[model samples]
Target chain A: MKPVIEIESISKKFLIPASSQGYQTLRESLTSLDFLRKKREFWALRDISFSMEQGETMGVIGNNGAGKTTLLKILSRITKPTSGKGRINARVASLLEVGTGFHPELTGRENIYLNGVILGLKKREIDRHFDEIVEFAGVKEFLNTPIKHYSTGMWARLAFSVAAHLDPEILLVDEVLSVGDAEFQKKSLVKMNDLSKNGRTVIFVSHNLAAVRQLCSRCMLISQGEITSIGNVNDVITEYTSFRDGDSPGTTDLTLISERKGSGIVRLTRIELRNSDEQVKGTFLMRDDLHIHLWLEAPVKVRNVKIVVDILNSFGETITSMFDSDSGFGLIEVEGSEHISITINDIRFYPGKYNISVSVISQILNHKYESFDEIENAITFDVENQLVNRNLTRRTGLLFLTPDWQIHKD
Target chain B: MAGYEIKPSGWLTFDFRELWHFRELFLFMTWRDIKVKYKQTFLGLAWVVLQPLALMAIFTVIWLKVMKPAELDIPYPLFAYSGLVFWGLFSSGISGAGESMISNANIIKKIYFPRIIIPASAALTALFDFVVTLFLLVLLILYYQIDVSLPRFAGLFSLSIMITMAASFGIGLIVSAATIRYRDFRYVMPFFLQAFFFVSPVVYPLALLSSDSLRIVLSLNPLAGAVTLARAAITGNPANWQAIFPGTLMTVFLLVAGLTLFRRNESSYSDLL
Candidate 1:
């Protein structure tokens, strides 16, 4: 079988300016002798090459900033590569983002037609699928109402329905199923599964590993703008997870991370994981006393500051969150540098790695709190159970419980 | 099944076959623009006629009452209103086409279609507005009792509108492509059009310019020729072939230049936008 999509040695280089100025005015560009010298080259993708068969369902898994979106854009023809060549033998439909061409002022019916045409469907094709789209979206009652007036869920449903009805030989989806309600996401996933089952090629890019494992027959892992592995779904996922655990589970530098969001008034300088002996450790036994230390800094004295810590499982889903206010810890006033520690006596996490995310919020006035700093997936640690008798299998779910049983005569 | 090769083509190589395949999208986009324009307004389609009629009223006060020019064979309102109709088409069409790509950056960033369709659809939407306004112009002619022969009126009116549209599309293509890279054009466009309004004979008769050289230079603006030819058709005055010829030639040149520049930059739009 021939490959439906063939990509050769493709590379894209973006001209990023060295200075902070986003764009230059026409006068400055014409008059300045240093105009050409000011720009630096940023290679978003380098010598990337891949090909896919006509009916294969492939999952593209990567960390943030891995150039996954750029690859999809090239395949969709939204942007062309700076070098090399590619070819697509079938009509391509890409859902880079849901509600891409949706206009708030247009009615739901009108927007369906608009989005359909934007997806490369003809007017007659849209008409043939109009009833199916409206019925599937369940917005027939409000078809004539402008989309701005619809509830957020209704709006997402309409957009997803319109995109789901796109009948192309190849579909390129990028994390669009993560939106909408849970039921809708499930329906979309099932629809995609059905499409692939009926001999349509699909390239799905998402952070949801479980969904990827479920829907894709093959998986490809990308790292640092290069494809590291491509093979069976299970093997690639294992390679990816193991690589991630081996790479950075030991330590994380807070200053090097630029993905954080918040005001710069207060900052989380560092985080440390320690045991009862007060020594930093990357692995722990089940039910061990886990101590988490946080270092913070503030330029001025701040009042009513709150700290929040979240524990996320291997799948990046938050298992639990610790808000200082939840446990009757009202607030702490900090002047400059402060060290805080929270210790849990009996940790119940199963034998798997977990990631920690931290955030700090300062209450400025009555009933008003501003996020000062937040770091997501800042650090990761592993948990191990030494007892062989204990059911330490990975399939025992996220929690390790201690139960009491008594024998009674019935 | 058709195979598509993804590579950069030569600057002058435009795929008209690809554009023909996406013609339905062009029509849908134009329809969407027209529907959205009229949907929110209370006056709806009435605003189409009211805009030019109101502009004619202002010009009548300024040129006819305040600064009276040479007496005309036709009523002053007919002359000014006819010119306003074509001028409205040119100005709105060019600006609309210029801003089309930027305003629809959401669609341009997400999907791929013939990039020309965005500006082309904008021109078509403007044409729709022109046709709607022409109905009011015909009523004005009937009200003034101008002897308009149907065959000559149809020919001149269609030719004049087409010329203005061609020029607008040409300018629109160049401006739209340039605006993607240099946003300063967005700010300068209004001022340029405002200055262009005076240079072209939109508000006054072309006869007011006494020197023959002056008329020739001004008539190089396609809108000047289009308005004069349209006015002459309605008023039954002898057409000025000398002034109209230069305008027609300039329109053709602009069309070719606009399409060439637009095609040269179309592939880079997704990156720049």
Candidate 2:
């Protein structure tokens, strides 16, 4: 298939505040607009290049400020690039955010025509598909009502329906799929999947890795305005997870997270997660052998040093907790500073991004010495379905396991 | 469905062919603006008539009844209403185009279009209001039994004058561009229009200011010529060509300059906004 969209080394720069304090006054704004101070140059995207075939769906994955949206804006022609150039052979439709193309005062019926025109659809084509569009949006009854009165869900559903129905050859969708309810999200997913299958070039950007994995045949991992990796969806995701997990400040960079008395006696020196190869790894699959290692220094000999590993999700919900001394429950002693290694085999977990918190504690909190050195979002892991038996089906919950099933005809 | 090719610097070069493709959209948006304006309002199109008529009444009292400036041999209401129609056209056109970018900020930031069409369409919308008020002026002319002289054809000159002043309203396009970057343009526009209203021949006829010294200065304001031409058309009188000609020239000059500024600034709009 011929490439429908070819992006050639495009970059976008923005002038953001060097100090992001509030601009509360017009005088302050005008002074800043004077341009001798306050503003700093930000390269939102830098020399990004990619090409997509007519029918390929490419997922763009990145953290916040990773230029995913900037690339999309440049491709969709909503904003001009600061440098370089890009070309697309077919029509482009973009839903960068929910309700981007909607006019609040206009009725849904009027908006359909307006949005359709915006998306490069002819009036007669919208007229022909008017019923289908309303039905798809599930706002058939309220089509005549001004959109301001519609619920956000109703607005999103109708806006997305108009955008999705345009049948544009190239579609750039940001993370706005998570706008409506779960059922609507599922329906939208199905629609996007269908669009991908139909061979229209699609560029999907979202924080939901599962959706990217499901719909995108290829993906790119961007970080700090550059493409760190690009290839198959799984490979790019693996690289991204590994990169993020590695760059997270470990126990070594504890000054930012250090909580200590003015005495300055004991401090966290380092932390390590050694797999079977003695190499640091935060990534783990379901039922994988895992190990935790730590090296610290103390002025005096410490006893009853217990290590607690708490896994937290992105929202700070603790998913699981494990105490190092719970199983072996031994009083270990360390002089000055010494490297300590702890191993746990058969780590059972789900497929998702997770955070690890490490705390050094004494079994008896009766005048405990060293406290929790803050390590936040320490690691993330993905669990894949690895089944050995043909009869075992892949399960859908946090932990994928074989469930006994019985089928009956009713 | 194909995307329009954008030149790096040329924003006002009208792609007539491309605009023609979206002609339906232009027409629909124009109609939608009109419908939404009159919808649910008790007066409906009467609001259009009321605006100029009310302004005419107030100006008549203030300029003629209160000040008793100059007789001008015509009824004050007719004179003020004539100027009010063109004044409404010019003022509303600029305000409409100035607010055009902000009001449609959602659509402007989302999709790509000939951004010029926005202000242009707003000017056209004010044209509708102007037409409705013009009908009222014709009724006034019949009631007064004004003579329709051969020079009345000079009123067609006012149509050209109306377009030129409307082009002058295209100055809002420049303001729209400025607003995208520094939103200070939004706060400054209403005050600018209000202050400009006093200088233009809206409240009083330009013919009333018959001083040889003040005539040139008043003629410099483009709306002065437009209002005078409009007054001549409705009241069946000779238009003051000396004032009207210079004002028309200024209108064309302001319009071309505004278009150039808007075109140069349009590309950076999305980035700044």
Candidate 2: residue A406 lDDT (0-100)? 97
Model no. 2, DockQ: 0.21
List the candidates' TM-scores in order. 0.89, 0.77
- TM-score (0 to 1) of chain B, per candidate? 0.97, 0.89
Q: Write the per-residue lDDT of candidate 1 for residues A157-268, one digit (tens) a residue.
A: 9988888888889999999877888898899999999999999999999877788989998988876567888889988876665523333444555666544657756888
- lDDT at A26, model 1: 73
| Candidate 1 segments exceeding 4 Å error | A21-24, A27-34, A243-249, A254-278, A288-311, A316-347, A356-378, A386-388, A401-410, B8-12
lDDT on C-alpha atoms for all candidate structures: 0.84, 0.70
- Which sections of candidate 2 miss by over 4 Å? A17-33, A243-396, A399-410, B1-12, B149-161
Question: What is candidate 2's CAPRI-style docking category based on DockQ?
Answer: incorrect
| Model 2, position B8: C-alpha lDDT score | 32
